[model samples]
Target: MKIALIGAGEVALCLATEFCKSEDEVVVLTSTVKPSLKDLKAEIRLTDYSVENLKKNLDDCDAVVSTLSGPNEFYISAHSNILEACRQSRKCKHFIPSEWNINIEDFPDQPMFSAATHEVVRNKLRSQNDIKWTMICHGWFMEYLLPTKKNPLREIGLAWAMNHGTKVFDMYADGLQKVTLTSTADAARAVLAVLRDSINTGADLPPVTHLAGQTLTYRDLFQLIRTRDPAWKSNPVTFVEVLTAIHEGLKANDALVAIHQMRIMGFTNANHNPKGKALEWGTGILQGLRATSVEEFLDQSEAGEDK
Candidate 1:
């Protein structure tokens, strides 16, 4: 089977590598060049978002998984192109949009820009019967919490939950609340499972899917981080504080500030928990690399740095 992976960044690379190990053809579709993948030999085709170019390249592919992400300036436009490409493809039936987030944030009412874009794309896909699409709502990227070898907080630039170098963390509620999270590798495994299941069962992929590597509270996360570094401190904040901010921001039409702040607030807030439409992958589905815990993820990340 041929899988056309859109995006050549780390996450895309992880998905591409995992897909290639299955003995399936993997083609990377990206406009940007990745120096990180220089040593890896694979087929990569660039896209300029031209309808003709994308349709030509995506033709005859079995699946398309888009992992593109960057500045909000061009994200919607770029992803729209990918969705269109997949829609126009002749052979590709399965498409997974870049919905690698928690199921709670998948609602259309969410004021977040990213959430809005996802809802928009999701609605557009719903009106079509030509192609099948599924979303991977795996909570937050667990990598943001894990320390990388090259840089202590290399992905900090992409994440907004924590302020990286700050020694103090103010979480909402009791901080004992758990939220869904999945490693890139784990998510890739789930995606692979979806691919196999979709092909063998001929089942229509759900509109939204969720995966949590290991559910733990904010206190557990902070304690684990402190256990590894021993200098970080965390404290609990009142939900009223966050609610006030959200109310004030929304009233002021400051959706960006309100939405971004809502992320940490919601994660720390237990009120949002237990209501998500999370997908449960039964045992033996993920196979080899099981979903890892916070402790294990840290060990792996630190161990890699030592090597």
Candidate 2:
């Protein structure tokens, strides 16, 4: 299958690598191509994400997968154009939007980013029928726990829910809320599995697909960290504190509002646990695929550090 990836970021690169492993033709469209993208066995096309450009580029593609992400306006606009292009494409029928997080449908208008970006795309897709699309929600990326050198994900230092150096973590609703974590590589494999199944059975992909490498509460996660480092302290920000932080962050237009909101969603059971058809389908398709567990991920990180 000829697949067109709408962005050249780590997620898209991961997908390209996985798809290429099957010897499928992969074309990555991006405004700026990173050096790592050249290392992949895929064609890289430099182009703006305009509707006309995407339509022309995706004309012969069998599937379109977007991994684009940015500010609200840019993300919404780019995805809108990509969806329209897919609709008008001659052969492109399957599309996977850049929804690599939780089920935005469950919690509407929260986490400002989802409200502005994902919700807009969902609304657009609701009104369209030309393109068959599915949103893959894999909870949190386990890569965040590892350093950039140890993983394919780009580093965003100290922006994650856990701060190992400080021995502090966000305790969302008593730190008992279950949050799913999946490695990018594993998520990519699950996506390909779904696509293959859809093509083989001539069935439409589920509206939302959930893939979980490990699902554990913050308390459980802390215990795992303790297993690695016996001295690791658990200084957690209480649920009330998280709520207060979110409110204050929003008032000050703080970037941390998104993080706090994510914690709240997990606490509220709206984003953490995966259920229904989405979970069943993803788990069924990934039966034989051994997903990397949180324990395995920590072991890998430790091994990388030892080197």
On the 0 to 100 scale, the lDDT of residue 248 in model 1 is 82
lDDT at residue 150 of model 2 (Cα atoms)? 61
> Global lDDT for candidate 1?
0.66
lDDT of 1 by residue, 225-267 (tens): 7777777776566666656766787788874554545455355
The TM-scores, one per candidate, come to 0.81, 0.89
lDDT of 2 by residue, 225-253 (tens): 77877766766556687779888998999
Which ranges in model 2 have alpha carbons more than 4 Å from their true place?
A: 148-151, 154-159, 275-284, 304-307
Which is the leading candidate under lDDT? 2
Name model 1 segments beyond 4 Å from true.
70-77, 105-108, 148-163, 238-259, 262-289
Model 2 Cα shift for residue 69 (angstroms)? 1.3
Q: How good is model 1 by TM-score? A: 0.81
